[model samples]
Target: MAGFRYEEVAGSIAGQVEAGVYGPGDRLPGVRKLARQFGVSVSTVVAAQHLLEDRGVIEARPRSGYYVRLRPQRPPQAPERTRPEGQPTQVTGQALVLRVVQAANEPDTVQLGAAVPHAEFLPTHGLQRAFSGVPRRYPGRATDYLFPPGPVELRQQIARRMADAGCRLSPEEIVVTNGAQEALVLSLRAVAEPGDVVAIESPTFYGLLQAIEGQGMRALEIPTDPDEGISPEALALALEQWPVAAAMLMPNFGNPLGHRASEGRKREVVALLEERGVPLIEDDVYGDLAFEAPRPWAAKAYEDRGGVLYCGSFSKTLSPGLRVGWAAPGRFRDRLEYLKYAASAATPAFPGFAAADFLARGGYDRYLRRVRGEYARAVARVRRAVARYFPEGTRQTDPEGGFVLWVELPAEVDSLALYQAALAEGISIAPGPMFSPTQRFRNFLRLNCAQPWNGNFERALRRIGELARERSG
Candidate 1:
């Protein structure tokens, strides 16, 4: 019993709290008293108290005593902020790099985890050609940080381009980021706090989930339709039930889900949030890479206030290596821009300059046409492969645009095990669980339709399916 003194003290105190004997706000015995009761040293009692404090069981008062702080309740979560309104008051933390490493180290694995495009889709040679000319056009631009809002020429180009989507932006509103990830991270950091709740799509992007986890914030998962994106009614309920500080969503071809929110719903969403004074962070990275007929509208088009923070990246349309993404933070422009500067100083200027050149060549739309055509064909091939290889009960989302396929396997199949099993056969796939804050997609997998259904990819899918069968069986 002597050796178990600290354990006894901690357990008895914890039991008191659990039993409501020491109700919230009630004071616990001091070190001397607890030591006398438990027959432990004063230091031992103090250590036990500190342990309880760290566990959020009690709080220390300044010469007053340790009292229960009521384990601070979090109000229910609200909907994620949609476009054209609301600030993204969410705190995001460090990104997970383990899954990335596994996929990178084993090149033979069937690739499907990351949102990165196939190496062939990248315009590496074209980038090189443009880079070579950067010196002649702006000799020292690459050597310097573009600063807060970004390079003037690049920002102007972005403003001019967004005109197509009816997003009238002043060059002053745009802040360049290393990638869309940085834009989301910085926007969240600017608007949210450590314990604030942020609503997100149920089967959202894993990276966003990791960001939420890293920031020590709470994620409220909202029901999302495969076609129409997040449910408006469900979001409104969340808003009413929870004290959400902000929300983040991918309005256009959301990562992993590959669904676009309708323009009408977008307006309704913004208006609802504006009434509640909430902010929205819109991820539109795949807005331009739609494989469907015409491009969908931008969420920012409906903005009448400063709540919407719009994010886009050239990685999908141009080159990932470029890592060029920009944000138009309507009301929080200064704060978002300052965060961008503080976080990374600025995005590499040469890429922005080169991207401007690429866009200015008047071939940007033409290139998009070609890219969409290829993506459409690729999606078709992958769909057929899924039909042929995956089990009969498998349900897959047919995204209207973009190149992600969220496949729901039979309830018996566990995606985490499938990921491990597939990796053994030189294949990689995103396990379903990572997409939600609580890892709810245990029976799901996100397939990248960006890659062609070639021998390697098909073989990978076949192996993944086989693994799924093994787990299911």
Candidate 2:
């Protein structure tokens, strides 16, 4: 579509400016030249140029085509790593998390609450063709009811992908699941008992908290760094003091905070847990979504002797509806496989077959290259908007990748109250309580930056900031 092609061109040009390819006031190539470069019509280039002008990414002169705009003021400082000081407690606040998440799924509301990728970012046509071709390509896998460990086609593809994360695995070692949530749940069950204590990052994904709650387990909130991720020293102290049975982490571009652990820190985490004989469930759902290439390695990459259980999903990078995820549950593979069978018998093979086909035949790498840039530009734009519109003393995370921004409002602004107020105004935001089991981060807000940059989105974000200031009053 011309609309999408123009957006792509606009995003690409914006990214070039972000990468310093075009400095402020530097004139961009003429529309015709850009059209030739991007292989689009002259009209599409004009539309894209108009879009850049509208978004303030560039300015135009009477005869001079366009030039990058001068950069804006720096955003607020990032919130420091959290210091969660509390004993392991049974997860609470599920009702609130559920309520906000459910509300975010509504179609009419301004959707700044959910971090789901927009459909424009998905390979819609390619996936449809892949799905239709699945039956023709793999007739048996498409029709047959696959048992646990799923179809070899999907697992093999997953294994191949995992190689980028610095893990060497085979199809037999991976168990396909409904999604990362299910894979995380299976990993939890495979290792710990119902009443055992499980350690987690300070402000982690709410879904994992719910999973821990469902299993009747307690979550030990560890002190995590905004820049470095879960602290190895803090985790060591927690293990020494508590009877932590297993630990879960997000090594690459974690949710809310969007912290990416350095490989050394990752190795330290893996080693610390191994030293304590505690299993590490590495949730790497956002690993592949790193804005730049040479994708970060999973903690499973630095495994000493297979104590790390790596869980990943295509839901974030690929289609979430596909519900394709896998777990490399080292040392607990058999148990996880059996439990997976007992819980769901087998995941639908058709999705996996389609995903495999898409990876093999479709331009997944090309898609990643494009979508990564889109998300990076989107996140940067949202950050700048927050800086321009939000009240002073409001700090937020400047993540290198991932499409979620964690904002720390002024102390007087309670995010829960803000969430309610914003909902009344037909806007949805994920309050800080949704990401924690202990209801910490009373003044924090996690804003989804996955939506396209548009006038409506800008208005909605500005409105949210206005509501926050009103609440602060």
Candidate 3:
């Protein structure tokens, strides 16, 4: 207990750093002074300073005392309110989406395109160890097909994690799928028929659009606020005007925009949909990656009736290669299970077993705390870089969570051209049009903030900004 006193001292210093008491590049009190202030020994103050230095909150000079590191600067402004057409638009960005997604996966390229977290931030070694033990632990289970609903252990772990998002779910209510993509597909299939119009957030994830188009459904893009998420007013108006079959949304840390709906807004949307008798499918893959304390609530949390189908995945938080995802489809549970059965019969057993093992071992929460802090710092660094390098007219989203930034460039700068130019330079960017069904947001682009901040990433960002300036000129 005496040896751990430094942690308390370090936390107090961190609090000061966060509270702006010790601003960027400002000198902190000397070790003796801090020791006297905290009533701790000089050795304890030294340990606390080391901890802060390791966490990147402060730095030490060769001959001088410690000084605060420069915090990530704020960007100019968030993008204005989105204005998408009210009517349904046929989805046609599948080919472009596929191309950009493939490019994002290329090796040796700076990846600022895909919304996936960098491998450096994930628990790759732990997951691999878990996977290694699965075969020996469950001899024949690895080879045999897991039943439709998937392994009970994995489902139970997922249900426990769901509570963090304000949803209390039973393991039996969850259906395991290959990934959140499949869960979303199953959810969409369970509720909407072919050719039905589904309302979605404008500038949403391209994968959602591809899935909607693949299902032979139309998309009605709703006006979304950068900070508050999809407008309840716009959604209510769309429902009143159109024959909307189902509504899909990412309420917490939405991809591209990274907008999170408030609890009241989420409840209002749910009540509106419930009154209209429309099923709601929620993609919450990024919910667990919130940078703030006390994770935001999912839209499913406010579901008084049973119209919310909540889909989540371990890909973002853990290894994407695991391909483990689950859906808690309320009221339509039977239909969703049937669809999951028809699609693949069962998810891969080993990944489920491994994930279950990982979660049960009690390491996930610790890992989340580490990664959440890293991602928050990384996002701030990326925002500061954008502000320094991007054209003067550029505006970007100040997302509360997740690792992606939506940048709105001048209208004269076409994002597609910027994408191509950036790709040639070994940089990948998700062009804005890919996120919209009607090819809107041509002047915007989404950048992945998951990668650690370094000189290489900074160069890539500057190059993209140069390309944008050239095009605009």
Ranking by TM-score: 3, 2, 1
Task: Tell me the TM-score of model 1.
Answer: 0.78
1 or 3, which is superior by lDDT? Answer: 3
- Model 2, range 1-473, lDDT digits (tens) per residue? 88999999999998787665775456899888998999999999999999988888888878767877643123448898789875999888878877777765688788888778778778888889988898789967677888889988888888888998999998899999999999999999999999999999989988889889999999999998887799889899998899999998887989889888999999888988888889999899888888667799999999887889889888888887889888999999999999999999988878888888888775677788778767776777888788878988889887767889999999999998899988888888999988888889999989888887788899989998998888776
TM-score of 3: 0.87
Candidate 2 vs 3: which has more lDDT: 3
Best by TM-score: 3
Clashes of 2: 1
Candidate scoring better on TM-score of 2 and 3: 3
lDDT of 2: 0.86
Best by lDDT: 3
Query: Residue 27 CA error for candidate 2 (Å)?
Result: 10
| TM-score list, all predictions | 0.78, 0.86, 0.87
Off by over 4 Å in 3: 1-74
CA lDDT, every prediction? 0.75, 0.86, 0.87
Model 3, residue 151: displacement in angstroms? 0.4
